[model samples]
Target: MILTDIVSRIYVLNLPERKDRKKEIEHALKQIGIHWQANQVICWPAIRPSSNNNFPSVGAYGCFLSHVAALQDACHAEHGWALILEDDAVFASDFNTQLPELAKVLSSEQADLIYLGHCHVASETAAPAGLNISTAAVIGAQGYLVRIAYLATLLPYLEACISRPAGHPLGGRLHYDGALSLFRQFNPSCRTWIAQPSWIEQRFSRSDIQAHWWYDRWPLLRQCAAWARKFKQARRHAATLN
Candidate 1:
């Protein structure tokens, strides 16, 4: 296995709406060889005050971010690797079958990040192809297989600075971008890809983002801003060359 030296621990980060989801995840884990420790699955309530300013708070996104931070820390403290999943995700056949080969691939290439497994192409016809070279295969976080050493640097900052998108009072925000920022901070030259053939099916942004109480928005917004700035610089350079 690519990471035989690293122990695999799985955790679910969840909120009130996710009780059923949590059960589903737990069952899936049990079916595999991983023994569940109660403390491993952490839950935080999503509690944002409504605009009315009188009713009880309700939102899960914020809580999700908080849990992500906690999981990152817990993974580091335990000296083990972590696989983080949302309540809604489901796995497929060969999930276990592919781990050894994937791990071998990671080790052979000296990869810094393992994106876990995800379907690069949603439909049946497409093929996955975002990896940079033999060393690193770019993959999505859908079913992430995070190495603790790589994630320790960003845990402290995750809970703070996340907020709703600009001009959208009731928008959804997340820290994938912020996490990417940390990936760049630690590695400088980060490579990513979708794992391939399989992926988590989440409701895309076709619906308006649901509001959440504890989701950090600022960090993500800042990351977005940075991305825009970089894109603009690239555009300018291209124009100059033209």
Candidate 2:
């Protein structure tokens, strides 16, 4: 199988209304020598929030469902791993060269989920020298790879959250990436990681979900908080393992 085929599947999430975004992503991928067929680039319709919806806005809900859709697809895929990307995600120039190395690391480590591109607000200290992967704290959903085995666990949990009554404790106050972080915290079996220097980065574009200025302005503070949370979670995970 070709190097691209090493990944069971690759998907780019696009909205029907964002045809321009789709074209832009296609162009970017072409520049990187990756060409995806129409079936591989899934166009998800944005979910409009209503009075009965759990999330704060239609955009938030749509974003959440789009990720769920990706996970659902991975659960049924014949391949062991899948790569999911948002339309605005851009590949690093070395991404093609690093793809095999990444796949080998994740497979050897048996990681459930790995962030390909995300904000660097998860840890205060750098990863051990030469280590490409470290535990993820607060990941952005722009680009990630998921193991099909882990999706088997994650998909059911997400479905449960979706079916819960409005106002339920686990209902919809959080974004999809946040929910995934919480899930990893609670479920030690679901290993997660981030690439030290991300292989992809999100291109600036009109965001579908609302933005928080506080997060943008105080990234160091956010990273500190994430580190604290991860520390507590590591302690708890250790207790369980013991």
Candidate topping lDDT: 2
For model 1, residues 1-242, the per-residue Cα lDDT tens digits are: 22233445555555555465566656655545444455544333322233422111223344335446555555645544566665544454335555665655555534444555443423344445433222232323445555566565545444332443422332224334334434444454444334554433321211112442232247676456546654764564455345
Off by over 4 Å in 2: 1-3, 38-52, 128-133, 165-171, 211-242
Put down candidate 2 lDDT per residue, 126-194, tens digits, no spaces: 675222545557668788888877777788777766666545666444567777776776676776767
The reply for model 1, stretches above 4 Å from the true place, is 1-6, 33-35, 38-60, 78-80, 105-109, 117-140, 156-188, 191-193, 199-242
Could you report the Cα RMSD, in angstroms, for every candidate shown?
13.8, 10.6
Clash pairs, model 2 backbone = none
Any idea how many clashes model 2 has? 0
User: Which is the leading candidate under TM-score?
Assistant: 2
**Span of 10 residues, lowest total lDDT, candidate 2:** 43-52
TM-score of 2: 0.76
Candidate 1 lDDT (Cα, 0 to 1): 0.44
